[model samples]
Target chain A: MQRYFVNADPSAEITLPSEAAHHLLKVMRAGIGTKVELVLADHCVYLATVSVTEPAAKLKIIQKLLSNSELPVSVTLACGIPKTKEKPELIVQKSTELGADKIVFFEAARSISHWQGSKQKRKIERLQKIAESAAEQSHRNKIPLVEYCKSLDALISDYPATKRVVAWEESAKQGETSALAHQFNGLQAGDSMLAVFGPEGGLTETEITKMNNAGIEAVGLGPRILRTETAPLYFMAAISYAMELS
Target chain B: MQRYFVNADPSAEITLPSEAAHHLLKVMRAGIGTKVELVLADHCVYLATVSVTEPAAKLKIIQKLLSNSELPVSVTLACGIPKTKEKPELIVQKSTELGADKIVFFEAARSISHWQGSKQKRKIERLQKIAESAAEQSHRNKIPLVEYCKSLDALISDYPATKRVVAWEESAKQGETSALAHQFNGLQAGDSMLAVFGPEGGLTETEITKMNNAGIEAVGLGPRILRTETAPLYFMAAISYAMELS
Candidate 1:
């Protein structure tokens, strides 16, 4: 069954947006009396039956399905803006599927690409759309939000979590085995975590110092050097391992 | 420093091949006295100095670098062949970076795309290249091999390991907890493990039953549904967490 996210409270009937209507009506060829899973404002999955169609799509609510696929911990991924256009998009799409709560792209010291003016909004909108689709495909309870931060400092200041950590390559080089797991083990349910990652050239000393000052512990993913896009996914998976698997 | 894999035994002096020579000279712009790390046939990391510049790239042994970046327990990822060309390539590349010992792509019941006569060779070659590049970039001690298995039976019969597990969606749907960690706890060093994953549409009940008959345990990754590419990565990170971090 196809799924769509609608920003409305759990009610009797709901209508999908134009894009989702097209996808359900044309792409999926859903007709009258078609059953689909719909997520409303309460972030709950409900079984809905198609009532009306054509230009606009309307659905009548059946019984709500008791589904819970959200991560126990709210994970916010703060990544340094990578050089390529595709890296952030890929990161957002994959992380959304992997159960990221939020994703923030911050401008780092060594970041080559900068989003300014209308480019920032357009890029974030495209990434947000990708996240929405990925969330539906993964059957996530909530769609991960995609946003941009002005700088590393602004990111730290804006999103303050219960636990904050940075994925430091130097930690892996120094053979710090238990830092990441230790950080993850300290997290509890409903406790938010903010994990920072570097770009292509990696985070500089000054950036690390600032984050350290803000009480963010530097942690290692593993011994191998993951690329800018790969590190966040690794972190996300490791988080899932700690909270969900273990 | 750049890293290269050389298929030579431990010796005093070694000359790089023509392809490596061109990559060092033209691509990396290595001078006569440039230092680079090489993983020889012994699978040991050794630092070497460029000795000769003419004809071919030659290097003299300086000293061995104490770099053991591999996972403690070997991980073999048996993935169902994905639909797109980019997916397998991405899987190989990312899994190599995450410390996979080997990657096997098997033809699954849900697989929509098939690797035909010459396309199989081309696809394997491309994925192999991706694995090699990812290995070098991640500073891995050994390059993970990319292989193909004709069927699930071939996969089960050929790849024998100490522990065999499958990432089953139904297990996750049943809210099973810590199946991967439970398997990881029983593993020892030098004990290889094989983890199976499904394609986009996912594994059928009959295929799961076949694996079960062959002593393959079905394990859930997490609560959320993971994409075909993301499942293996979650397995890799979970293994790393169990062996290296915890």
Candidate 2:
């Protein structure tokens, strides 16, 4: 069954948003009695059926299903805005599939592209849509939010978690292999983690110093030099393997 | 410093391959005395400097550097051919970065796209180039080979490993979480692993049954559903975490 994120309370009849209705009715060609999964506002998956489609596409809730496809510890990936437009899109899509709770693109000292004014809002909206689709495809109960942080300072101040770490390339260069595992070992269920990554040129020394002072320890993904976009996905997967699978 | 994979013995002077020469001379604008890291035929990183740029670029090896950026256990990803062209490219590139030793695409029962005759050779050549570039960017000692197997039987017979597993969605649905870790725990350093994945429609029941009979264990990545391309990368990352990082 196809899944859609519906923003409403559990009721007898539920109307899907316009975009989802268009996808169900026109794109998927779903008709009356077609079954689907709707993730309502409570972040729960509910079995639903297409009941009415004349005025608007409405689904009748059948029953709530016991589905939990989220990470034990919430992960918030704060990335330094990469140079190309496709990097953020790739990060959001892949990280969401890997079970990220939130994705934030922050302006780093070495960042080339800056998300400003209405461009920031438009980009966030587009990325949020990508996250939603990815979440549905991955059968995730929660759709990860996409946001933009104006600077490293704003990111440090805003997203506080039980644990904070920066994916620093120098850490790997210095052979600091155990910091990431150490961080993972300390995480408990329901604890949130904030992982920061740099852009193309990578994070500046001053930025690293500031983050270090703010209690964000620097860790490495592995020995290989990962590109700006690949590091976060690696971190997400490693965390999932450590916490969920292992 | 720029890195290039040169298929030559560790000699005092080494002539760069045509493609690497063009990239070093034209793309990087490297001149005499420019430092570079070359992974010679012995699977070792050598510090080299540009010695000649006339006719063909040449480099003089200074000294061998101690570097090992590979997973402790060798990993071979055997994926069922994906539908779109981009998914294979993405899988090849990302898996190479994540330390895959080899990547093979086999025709699955549900595969929509088929690679035949010269088309197969051409597609493999293009994907091999992608793997090479990704390997260099990730500073890998060995460039992972990109291959196409005609069928699943061919994949099973051609590449024998110490451990063989398949990423099956049914295993995840059934909550088989410990199987992957169990496989990883059984692996020793220098041991090779073959991980198989299905395509868009996924592997047929017959294919799964055949693998099971062959003693290839079915392992679940996690509760979330990964796309045909995402599952192999997830397996690669998980193995690296289990064997290399943790």
* Best-fitting candidate, scored by DockQ: 1
RMSD of each candidate? 1.0, 0.9
Candidate 2 yields a Cα-based lDDT of 0.93
Model 1 lDDT per residue over A1-115, tens place:
7889999888546889999999999999999999999999999999999999965899889889999888899999999999999899899999998899999999999999998
- Residue B49's lDDT in candidate 1: 86
Question: Candidate 2 chain A vs. true chain A: TM-score?
Answer: 0.98
Q: Candidate 1 regions off by >4 Å?
A: none
- Put down candidate 2 lDDT per residue, B1-246, tens digits, no spaces: 789998888954699999999999899999999999999999999999999999989899999999999988889999999999999999999999999999999999999999999999999999999999999999999999999999999988899999999999999999888999999999999899999999998999999999998889999999998988888878887887787778
> Each candidate: fraction of true contacts kept?
0.86, 0.65
Q: Which ten residues in a row have the lowest lDDT in candidate 2 chain B?
A: B236-245
TM-scores of chain A across the candidates, in order, are 0.98, 0.98
Residue by residue across B44-93, what tens digits does model 1's lDDT show?
A: 99999899989778999889888889998888999999999888988999
Clashing pairs in 1: none
**lDDT by residue (tens digit), candidate 2, A1-246:** 799998899964599889899999999999999999999999999999999998899999999999999999999999999999899999999999999999999999999899999999999999999999999899999999999999898998999999999999999998888899999999999999999999998999999999999999999888888889889989988999999888
